[model samples]
Each structure stands twice: as C-alpha cells, then as structure tokens.
Target: MRRLIIFALFALASIMAPIANAQWQEAYNNSGAFNGFHFTDSLNGWFSHIGSQKIIHTSDGGNTFDVQLNVALPFNMYDVYMEDNLNGWACGTNTGSGPGYIYRTTNGGADWIQQTHPASQSHWIQIEQVGSSIWFIGSQSVTPNNLLIMKTSDNGSTWDLTSYSQFDASWLFIFDSLNFIVYADEGLLALTTDGGNSWISTTLPSDYQVQRVSFKDNNLGYALVANIWSN
Candidate 1:
C-alpha cells in the first residue's frame, strides 16, 4: 500500500502580495500510495512508493513527476532522504525477513546503487543524514521486533550500529555525538546524553501528545504538541 502526497505551492506572484494573502495550491497526487517524499528545492524533489521498488522524481516543481529508479520486484521503500538534487539515499527491505536495505544515488536518482550492511534482519523505516555524508537509519527486525539505529560516515562504505529499547519510534535527530534524540515509545522521546552508549526516555503530560519533535541545541528543543483529552 502507498499513501497520497499533497504539495503546497505558495500563492504569491507579485511583490505587492501580502504574505498573509498567500494560499496553498494543491500540486500533485499519485495513483497509488507513496510513503515518503523529499523536496530539495521548489523545483526539484522525489517521492517513493511503499512497494514495487519505485522512486519517482520531479524536476519542475510539482507540475510533473517521473519514475527515476525502480529495481526488480518485491523491494519496499519505507523512507527516502536526499541531500540535494544530485545525492540521496533510500532504505527498506527486499523480503518478508529483512536485514534492512540501503540504496545510494549520487547522480540525481538516475541510478541507485545498493549499499551493503551487516547480517541483521532489520527492516529500515526512516532515513536521515547529517552534514554531507553521515547517514542514519531507523530499523526494526522482523522476527523478534528489535529496533536499531544504523549509521554510516562515508556514504554507505562503513556503518556503525546501535541497538535501542524502543520498537515503535521512527524519528532520528542527531546533534553531534554527545547529544542525540529519537522517538521513544508511543508518547515518549528517547534521549542520549552520552552519545549512543546509553539512552533514557522522557515524555510530556498525559493530556498532551507530541505530534512532531525537533531540537536546535543540546538542551533546547520544541515539540508540536496537541491537547488530546483536554477540555
């Protein structure tokens, strides 16, 4: 299955247009469910399908999109991240039992090369990058429901692995080695103050649920929270 993607284009064309007057214009919608998308700029971007090993791209904003890469059969892309219009990576699995799979493309998704990893059946669901080449991925092993964070410094040539205790978290935010954060369980955030050596979970009040999370400094951050049952 895939999900629909909606792109919003700013409705401002003239210099005299007020910022409040700008509206969101519907841009693109695919036929099937596409799980992930990343826009390098207003004019270039790509989206990935959940199944059938497909990654679609659009160079002219959301006006059009074309399949840039598609592998053989049975490969599912759960997440995709592009560093720019020319360099990016995607992650998923190829079978029911997954050791996780990572693919790298240096030529604007014209060709994707599968990067190798160690022998652990992890189905990666989220991909993120730090700086130019350091990449991180979140994965869950199929057999035992184990979760892991995979990191690579030089593209995918080498990887460092860390296993954590959360099975339902999908977000990875790295802010140097000493301070890093990932999603904890259902309503928590996993924090690592001493790098990946150890981790602890924190959460907000029961009435609020974090819809999104981000951090700019080691101790400063923000969460988009929603009042769940508050009256």
Candidate 2:
C-alpha cells in the first residue's frame, strides 16, 4: 500500500507539471518600462515604453531588440500595434495639457509620422487594428475622467467618437469592426455589436473591479475580476 500511494502521488505530479510550466515567462528584459506590446507573429514584435518616445522592435522572436523612432521628450509612447512588419501605429500623450498623439510607421518603424485626427486632441490610451478599421480608446482630457472610443476607417484621416459617461472604462477588446467589449473598474461591462452605435451594459454581482475581458467567440467570453465573492 505504501508503494501504491507513492506511485499515485508521482503520477499526479507528472500530470500537473505541464500546467504549472505553461504560465508566462520572461522573454526579454530591458531598462525602460514597457506599457504595451504586440506581435504580428513569433518572429516580429514591438513594445512601447511609458516614459520614452521610442519603441523597441524584435525581428528574431525577441532574441534581439532594436530601438526605432526616437521622438522628443514629454511625448510618452503608451501602446503599439503592428498590422504587419511595415505598417504600425503608436499612441500616447504629449505631457501637460496637450492632446494625445498617434504616430504611424509605414517602412517598419524607420520613419514614424504623427497622424492627424480630431481625437488626437484628447488623451488616447490604447490603439487597436480591426481589419481595415482602426480604433482608438481614450479619454477627452489628460485627467481621463471621460471615456471615449474613436474609430477611423480611412486610417486616421477621419474619426467618429463615442463617449461613455456612466462608467469609467479601463480596457477594451475589439472582436471586429462592429463587435467589441469594454470593461470598467466598477463591475461595468459594455458590449457593442453594431459598431459603437449602440451598447448593452451589464453589471456583475458584487463590487468586484473588472480588470480585463476576452472572448473566444461572439457567444463565449470571460472576465477577470479583482476579487471573488462567496455565496
């Protein structure tokens, strides 16, 4: 019986070892603070720094990184998204009371030009690419009390802004040009299927703050909350 118990324990340990090792591991370490990162594939990826105006790109799957597009100070890079190796966008603020800015790189970050938009006059937080549409999630001011979602189909030449007043959105996930989800700190979850023209709001039980949300499909999704509640 002793031998049987030890064998059972070893089998269970073997079964659980793969699950424990599947968590996130440190791939690369740098001196600057990375606010957001996205990879087009395993070979190409980019990361933006919070305090600096530069972005780091790795071509060989993070084995090496090269700094590109160094703008002046006071313009922090918050989020970066690359549609491909050549076309990419980065969004951030210009310090003080200045509006947020979006920079685009066509030749793989060799040159980044600030794209002009009406929403660029606000504090942008995140940028996402959905098909041919580009979405910008941010606030109207630097303090970021008012949440806004701006979409541009013509690649930042024109923008349509959708403002939310009830809940302060923390993060957003775009499923497509028409469907997306936005979650807030106070258990607020909003869904939009007809683009940002309409939104359905749902509140989860308890005061659990929502951190992030993801959907496997249009019907199945999950939300990450800060705390768990008991019955």
Candidate 3:
C-alpha cells in the first residue's frame, strides 16, 4: 500500500507539470518597433513603439490593442507611466533636432497634451510623480556632456531645470517632494533631504558605473552597478 500511494503521487505531479510550464501566447503583432509597455491591471494596458506616432492600448488583457493616441511623428515614445486607468504620461525625443517632450493624458490615453518646459531639451528617460507634482530626468545636448533634471508642480504646465556640472544624470528616484536621489555617470550618487535647494554627494568605487538606484523607503535602498572596462 505504501508503494501504491507513492506511485499515485508521482502520477499526479506529472499531470500538473504541463499546466505550470505553459507558454505565453502571442497577443498582438505590429509593424512598428515596440520599446516600452505598461499595464495597470490584468485587463488594461498600454505600449509604445519607436517608429510609430501612436500609442497602443488594450482593454481585454492584450487580446486586442487599439490605437489610443495619434500624435505627430518623430515623438517616439520611449517610456510610459500610468497612475491609473485614467491618468498617465509618456516621454520621448523629437527625432529631429529639438527638445523632447512630456505628454499627459488625463482621459485614459485617449488624448495627450504636451507639457511646457523651461527650455528646449533632448530626451527624458524617466518620470516620477509625488502627489500633484511631476519630475523628469534626462540628458541635454548643450555640449554633448550636459545632464538635466526638471520638475513641474502644476502637472507639467511649467518646469525648472537643475544641472550637475558635466555629470551625466541617468536616473531619478523620488521618495517624496522633499527627498529624492539621482544616479550619475561616474559612480556618483546625489541625495537631497531638504528638496533641491542643496544636495549631499557620495562616490562609490570608481571602476564600477552606477546604472540604477531604487529605494523601498527612506532608509532602505539598492543600487545596480556595472563594471567599467578600461582600455
């Protein structure tokens, strides 16, 4: 009886293995190159493409995607963030020779309006939101060595720019309106506890480049580092 029970358990495990290892089904196919995708829930999702001027949306868990916004070309959407089904933002470069843009969609990506900035810029790679304020971080082509950090308090109506003397700013992580962190090119990390008025800097091992930094809260955080190969 003991041997029979063990054989039964093994047979049951074999039957359940296929269901656990099921493959992901292809949901949508398009000619444009897809760059970024975001899903707020199981049923609602959005995706951005590089060559296309429109953003795709799906209401049925990606079974079918519809063209949600038909903005002009050259604004290749690089990243998208949605607070919910209704409020969201997308960022990308102009592909021509002008500054990039931050677009906001309040009605579930059906319509997007470009937000005004303090100056013409290049690319905005990341966006963070705290309450009603939004923050953007990206590089500017002032001399091929300029990095910029911009913030908007009235939901992208206006922006303010901050620069760090030749350091290439790559990522922005916001803990709140008063505190945030930025990762730079040369293993440099900047922390601000009293808003953007001042900052404290710390340098890690010079050989490793900081790629990304994230914080779970004010006290706990993690940094991803990559080794810089030298000639």
Candidate 4:
C-alpha cells in the first residue's frame, strides 16, 4: 500500500498524454467494489472483492475474469499475493473477534483452501511473501495490544506466530526475510533483524513520526514522515 502513491504519481504522468499502445480500460462491471489484487505476470492475475466472498481471476490481463473461489466472512480479503499463477495466498480481518483467516491456493485458483495459523482470533490486513516465508501482520482491530506476526517458511504446511504487545500500529515493511520495520507509534519504530525474534526500538524526535519506510538494505532506507501537529 505504501508504494501505491509512487505508482499513482507515475500513472498521472502517463495518463496526461497517453503511452504508445498502453491505455487504461475498464476491467470489471460498475456493480460492487473490488478491494485488492495481485498479478503473477502481465496476463495472469486475480482480484478480491469486498462485500462478498468471491475472488476473480483473469488470464488475459483484465479483459475477462472468471470466478475462482469463495470463502467465509468477514466476506472480503484485505490483500492477495500471487507468487505465480499456481501458488498464492489471501487474507483478511475477521468479524467479531473471530480467528484471523488465511486462504491458500496451490493450483492456480482452481481451488482455495483455508490454512490454519497460530494467532488465535486475530485480524490480518497485510500479507508479504519473502522467499519461502509467508508473513502476516494483524491484530484484534479493537486494539494493538494483541499485535500478531505469523510466518510460514515452508509454504503453508507450518506456521510460526509471535505476538508483540505495546504496539499501536498495524502496517509493517519487510526489507527481507528477516529484516524489516514496524511502526511502534508515539514517535517510534521497531526494527527487527532476526525474523522478528527480537526488536530494537528507535525513538524519533519529539516533532516527527514516520508512517511508512522502505529499505535498500540494513544501513540505508527512506521513510514517509510527518510532523506531530500536521493533519
């Protein structure tokens, strides 16, 4: 989601004059809202809809989409990450304190099966795939007191969940399989280098806070920050 702004700015530039053979076109009906999507390549991709339990897939870019799979509620996926056309995962926040839900498809969305994870009754809003590890970050929605990070290094066969208390944010940026950053609120950010086993907290100045960050490596990165009194 953090990278969306970068894409939007680039889109605006191209849209002003159009690009050779590339143009924006409608891919779906104007009926309901589609929340998130992932594409394995230019021709194969999938999109998940809100307000429903259905997921859509298209092999010809966005020209046509077929109903791929349906799962349980909160009835919408927060994100979908397709490693390829054949293997992928989707996740979302649950309703009314239900267990955080994750769905996996190993056969190109031919079938989507729910996978079990270690966060007992949590809400997952983000899923990132780094190498063989599938990482998820979520909480209870009511509070970040139950912030949970779930990881699976060997596909969906096994999962490792670690919870961190005293955090007030949900978004996380994984620089690699083990090194990443998570917002800790109150002008602080948590940095993890051992696959979230431990954290070294860094406090920002009294007047600034960082909302998002991207890392080129452990020693170099960039952040989107704002003043404490800004809107």
Measured by lDDT, the strongest candidate is 2
Candidate 4 lDDT tens digits, 99-174: 7678888999899888887666688877888777888888765555567788888887788877777565367888
> How much does each candidate deviate from the true structure in C-alpha RMSD?
6.4, 7.9, 10.2, 5.0
lDDT of 3 by residue, 1-231 (tens): 111112123345765787996888999887778866889999999888767866789999978889977666657777778889999988877765457777899999889888767657567767767887666767774566456777777766667787755457467678887787767556677888887678788867666566767665678676766666645
User: Candidate 3: lDDT over CA atoms?
Assistant: 0.73
Model 3 lDDT at residue 153: 76
List, residue by residue over 35-78, the lDDT tens digit for candidate 2.
Answer: 86999898999988776677889899978889887777687788
Clashes of each: 5, 0, 1, 0
Clashing pairs in 1: 2-33, 3-33, 3-34, 98-121, 99-121
Q: In candidate 1, what are the lDDT values of residues 97-204, reduced to their tens digit?
A: 767778889999989888888746777877766555455555556644656777787877777886665444356667866676765334556777896677787755
Regions more than 4 Å wrong, model 4: 1-22, 31-33, 141-144, 184-189, 197-212, 215-231
Instruction: lDDT winner between 1 and 4, please give it.
Output: 4
Higher-TM-score candidate of 2 and 3: 2
TM-score of each: 0.75, 0.79, 0.73, 0.74
Error of 4 at 76 (Å): 2.8
lDDT against true structure, model 1: 0.70
Candidate 2 segments exceeding 4 Å error: 1-19, 22-26, 142-144, 205-207, 228-231
Cα deviation in Å at residue 229, candidate 3? 2.9
